[model samples]
Target: MSNSFSDMLKKNFNIDLNKQQKAAVSHKDGPAITLAVPGAGKTTVLICRTANLILNHNISPDNILSITFSKASARDMKERFNKVFGDFIKYDVKFSTIHSFAYFVINEYARLKGINFKLIEGNNTSLNKVRILKTIFHDVNGGYVNDDKLEELLNTIGYVKNKMIDISDYSSYTVPQIKNFNIIFNKYEEYKQRNNLIDFDDMLTLTLRILKSNPYLLDKYRNKYRYIQVDEGQDTSKIQNEIVKLLCANNNNLFVVADDDQSIYGFRGASPEDLLKFEQNYPTAKTFYMEENFRSTKNIVSVCNSFIKSNKYRYDKNLFTRNENKRPVTIVKTRDEHKQYEYIIKKLKQSDDLSDSAILYRNNLSFISIAEKLDKSNISFYVRDSKLHFFKHWVVNDIVNFLKLALNNNDVQAFENIYYKMKGYLSKAALRYVKEQDNSISVFDRLTTYPDFRSFQIKNISILKRDFKKLVKKRPFEAIRFIENSLEYGKHLKEYCKKTSFSYEGTKTILSHLKTIASECNSIIGFLTRLDELQALIKNSTAKKNNTVTLSTIHSSKGLEFKNVFMIDLIDGEFPSLGSIEAYEFGQVEDLEEERRLFYVGMTRAKESLDLLAINEKNEEKVFISRFINELEYIMKENDEIPSEFSAWMKIGMIINHKRFGIGRIMDIDGDIITIKFKSIGIKQLSLNLCIEKDLLKAANS
Candidate 1:
C-alpha cells in the first residue's frame, strides 16, 4: 500500500521493484489492470502486490485468491510466493486455475444444497458427451454422423459455453453452426443431468448459477476472497469475466495483469474485448503499463512491437528491452523444405548449445520431414501429437489414393499404392506386364489392354472404365460409387478394420464425407483438384516439437524464451494459416487479429536472434511470404535462388480465380506484367503482383 512495502520487498526478496512495477504493487484498492508486456516482470509484480496486501494492508491470507491460466502457472506462482515471502504465506493462500477454483466453489455449494454431482474432467468426458450427441444426431438426422462433424459440434458447444449463451437461445443466433450446437448441447446437458455428472464447463456455469441464485453464498465467496488477482486476464472469456466479477462484488479488491496484444486465444472463445472494456466494467479501475521487456534483445523486441503495432484492436504499448545492439531480425529465403532443413542442421552444428535454438513452425505437418531428418541425424527433440497412427490408416490412405488417381490418370504414386494394397485381386506380375506394355498409360487403363489379364481383373477394369466414362457425363458421385463397388473397397475395408481393430463405423463415416464432397463437384477432375487442395490445407494446419534444436508451433512456443528462434514456414497460407485472411471474407475480423497476435507471440519468443523463413513455392504453386514480413522494419536477406524482394511469390503457371472472370491459370509473369487464360473470359494480360495487391485476383488454391 506504500513505499515501505517496497522496502520490505527489497529487504526480504532482494527485488527492487522498477518504477512501473512499484506503481502496480502499490495500487491496493478497487479494480486495476497492469498492462504487462511480454517478458515484463508481471509475476514479480503479482507476487509482490499480493505480499504487500497481506503484510501492509493486514489482509488475511485466506481472503487472497490468485487465479492464473493453467495448473503449471498456479504452481509456479505458489513457488515464487514461497520463495519471496518464505514463512509468511502459510495459511490458505489460494493459488489455482480459474477452472479449479470454480470447481471448488461449485462442489462446496452442491454439497450445501445436498446435491449429488460428479465433476467430470472435460478431456475424459468429451467422448461421453460426443456419444450422447452422436446418438441424438443419428435419431434426429436419420443416421448421419462423423468425427469431423461431431468435432464441429463440440467446438460450437465450447463457443456457446465460453460466451455464456443459453442452449435454448441458439435459434436466435445467426450462425447456423450455433443452432446445430444448441441441439447437441440440450441433449448433452440432459445426458449429464441424468448421470449426475458435471463437465469442466459446468463447473464455471454452475458456480456462476449458484452465486446468482443464492445471495448468501455469493456474499460468502465475495467476502472470502476479498483480494483477487487474475493473471493472463487478457485471455478471459465472457463467462470467466462474469464469474470473477461476482466473486469480487463485495470487496472490489481486484487486480489483473494483461496485455491485449498477447491475447491470441480468440479462436478458443477467449476475448481481448474483456480486457479492452475492463475500464467500463470497473469504472473506477486504474490502468498501469509495464513496457520494459527483460527477455528479448532490443532489436527482437522492436520487431515484435512494430509487428503488433499494425493491429488496431490492442492497447497502445511498445515493448522495450534492456539488451541493446543485438542482430536485427533476419528473413531467410529457402528453395524448399529440404533446403530449410539443411539450414537448420547447419545452424545446429554451428550453435554452442542446442537448447538455445528453436525451429518454430505454423503447424506440425511442416516438420514431419524435418523431424525425420533430425531423427536420422540422431538429434533429440520433443513433439506432442497423436500416436493413433491415423496417418497410416489403411482405409483412409486407400481412399485418398483413389481420389488422387481420379485427379490424374498418370499418377504413378497412386497406381503403386493401389497395386500393393489390392495385390490379392490385381497381381504384381500383371501390374508389371501392364507397365511394360505401356508405361505412359494409367494402370487402370493398361489393365484393360493387358494381354494376359484375368477375367475377374478385366471385370474390375471394366467397372472403372464404365465409371470413368460416366464421370465425364454424369455427376462425380457415380465415379466414387463405382470405384467403391467395383473394387469391393467396403468389403476390403471391413477386413482391414477387423485386422487392424480400426472402427468399421469410421470407414462408413469417411464414405459419407466423400459422397458429400462428390455431390458438390461438377466433374471428377474438379472434385479431385478441390480435394487435393483441402488435403494440403489440412496438412499445413497447426498442431508442435521441443529440445536438440527446439521444434515448435507458434502456439506452443508462447511464454518461452529462446537464444535464437527460427520461425519457419512464414508463407501466407501457412503462417497466417489458410483461414485467417478468409475469415475476413466471412466477416470474422477477430480471427485475423488473433493470427496477427500469434505471429507477434512467435517473434517475441526470441531472446537474442530471430530468423523468419519462407520459400517461394510449394507443390508448384507460388507461396506468398507473410505480410508481416514486409511490415518488419528490417532488410531481408535474399538468396541467389529467390528473386529480389521475394518476387517469385507470384509465379508463372500459378492458378488464379477472378471473381468476375472465373478460374484462370497464369501463362507468364514478366516483372509486373502477367498473362492469364481464363476459361470464361479468355486470355487476359494484367499486372501480376499488383493485381493481387488490388484484390483483383486471388490464388484459387490459397
Candidate 2:
C-alpha cells in the first residue's frame, strides 16, 4: 500500500517522497503525531495524507477537516489540495484556522442553546483593543491602569483563558499583578457578554463549553470530522488542543504536524507540550519524526540542529539536509550601527536578487534605523506588518524628544524636533540665540539669558534642567518618574488628545512599551543608549519605495523563507533580550529555553546564506554576543578584515579545557573573542589569540 501511495505521488504531483515523508503519509489509523523539522515537506505529507484518506480509505472529503495556524496557511493548504486533486476535490472540504472552525461549530448549533452571538472585531490593533478595554473598565479609574498595564492584563487574561482557569480561582495566580488583572478581567469578560459579542479567544472557550454541555452536538462533530489534521500543532494552546481532542474523541483519527523546537509563541499561550505528550493525552496515539530538511543547506541545518539541541523541552530529533553547501555561516562584526548598515548594503549590492534577501531583528525598534540606512544607500526595502509610526503621536513625540535631549544634551536633531513641536514654548529669535552661543555651554545653559523667553517658560526650563541633571545620575525608573512629574507629560497628552481627537488610550499604549524598556535598563545612560537605538530607527517619512529589502521581527518571520537572511543585533542583552534577564534571575529555565527556540526559528528561515551580525563596542568595557550562538561554528570577519577559519576549529557543545577555568563548553563568539562556560570558574570571555598563545584552550574534537 505504501509503495502504491509513493507511486501515485510521483505520477500525480511529479515529486518523490523521502523516507521520513513517506512514513508520515502512510500512518492512517488511530491518533498520530508527526514531529516535523523545518523545511521537511510536512505540508506535502499533510496534503497527501488527507487525499489518501479520501481516495483509499473511502472517507468523505467533508468528513476530513484540516486545521492550520493562520488564514494564509489555510489558503495555501486549500490551493495545494486543489492543485493535487483538481476537479475531484470536494467543495465541502474544510480548510480553516482553529478559531474559525471553532466559531463555525458554535455559531451554527449555538442557537439551540438560545444564544445568538456576534463576534466583536477582535482583529483591531493592540492600541485599538486597549481603547475598548478603557470603555469596559472605567470603574478602575484612569482607564485601566495605563496602557502597558492594560496590555499586560490582556495578555494575562489570554493566558488564564488558554489554561481554562475559572475566574473564581484567582488564588491560583502567583503573580500579584495578574491577581489584580483577574478582578478587572472578570468585569471585562462580563462586559463582552453583555454586549452579545465574543473576541477571538472566546471562540475557543465558548465553543468547547457549548460542545461539552451538548453531548448531542459533540457527537455530531465527532462523526462529522472522522479524520482531523492539525498543522503547526506546536503553536496550539491548551484550549485549542482540547477542542481537537473532543472532536476526535470517538473516532480517534487525528494527525497532528508540529515541530516542538520551532515552538516560539509560548508568550502567546502556545504550549508545545501538547504535541510532546500526545501519546499521554491519547493512549492510542502513534508518533513519527521527520528530520530531513529539504530547504536550507546542510551547514545551515547543522547549526540550527546544534543550537536547538541545548533546549531541554523539545522532542529529541536530529535534522539533516541533502544540500552540501559548506559555505560557513558568516559572522560580521562592526564597530557601530552605522558600520553594520554599511556592511549590509555592501552585501545587498552583491546579491543577484535583492528581494530574495531579508534583514531580521529581535525587535521592531531596529527596523527604522535599518530602513533609513537602506533608503540612504538607494536600497529599497519593505517593513512587514507595518504599524503607524511611533513618532507620529504628536504629543508623545514632543515628550520623548525632550527626554532624548535630556539624555544627551548634544542631540541637536532631538532639540530641533522638540523646538518645532512646542510652538509657544520659545520664540524663533530666542532659539537662534541659544543655537549661536559658545559651543561649550549646553543648550539649556544658553537658554538662561534669552531675552525673548517668557518668564513662565523660563521657570519650566529651569525645573527641566535641574531635574534632568539629577536624572542622568539616577536609576532608569527614577529618571522616568522625574520626567513624568517635571514635564507633566500626561497633562500634555490630554491637551493633545483633545486638539487632534487622538485616542489617548492608544498614545498611552505606545508610551507603555517605551516605559517597559526604560524600567528594565540599569542606569540612565543604559536607558539613553536604548532610547538612542530606538530613535535611530524612526520612520523616515520622505522615502517611500515598494521594491526594497524586507525588514521583519523574528516572530513575524515564521513560515517565511529568504535566500539571504541577515539577523542583526545578535548582542547578549538584545536578542534573548532584557526580558530574558527576569526569567534567568527567577530561574525560569523554560522561558530561557523559549528564547533559544526563537533563535532556532530565526536561523532556520534562511535557505542559502545566513549572516549573524554583532557590533564590537569601541569605548565599552566589554563586548558580548548572544550565549545562544557561542558554540556554533562560523567564520568571523571584522570590518574590512579578511575572513579567517578560526571558528572552524571550535564548535558549540564541544568540551574544551581552559587554563584557569578547567573544562567547559564553548558558548559564543564575537570578533576575536570566544565565551565559554566552565565548570569551575563559571562563564568567562577569553581572547582567541591569547587562548592559543597560552595553550589555554583544547577543543574536544581535537
Tell me how many residue pairs clash in candidate 1: 0
All candidates: CA RMSD (Å): 13.4, 11.0
User: Which candidate's lDDT is highest?
Assistant: 2
TM-score of 2: 0.72
What's the true lDDT of residue 55 in model 2? 76
Q: Model 2, range 525-610, lDDT digits (tens) per residue?
A: 67657655544543442233444578888988899898889998777667676567567888877777888888888889999788
For every model in order, what is the number of clashing pairs? 0, 10
Lowest-scoring 10 consecutive residues by lDDT in candidate 1?
637-646
TM-scores of all models? 0.70, 0.72
Q: Give the Å shift of residue 247 in candidate 2.
A: 1.1
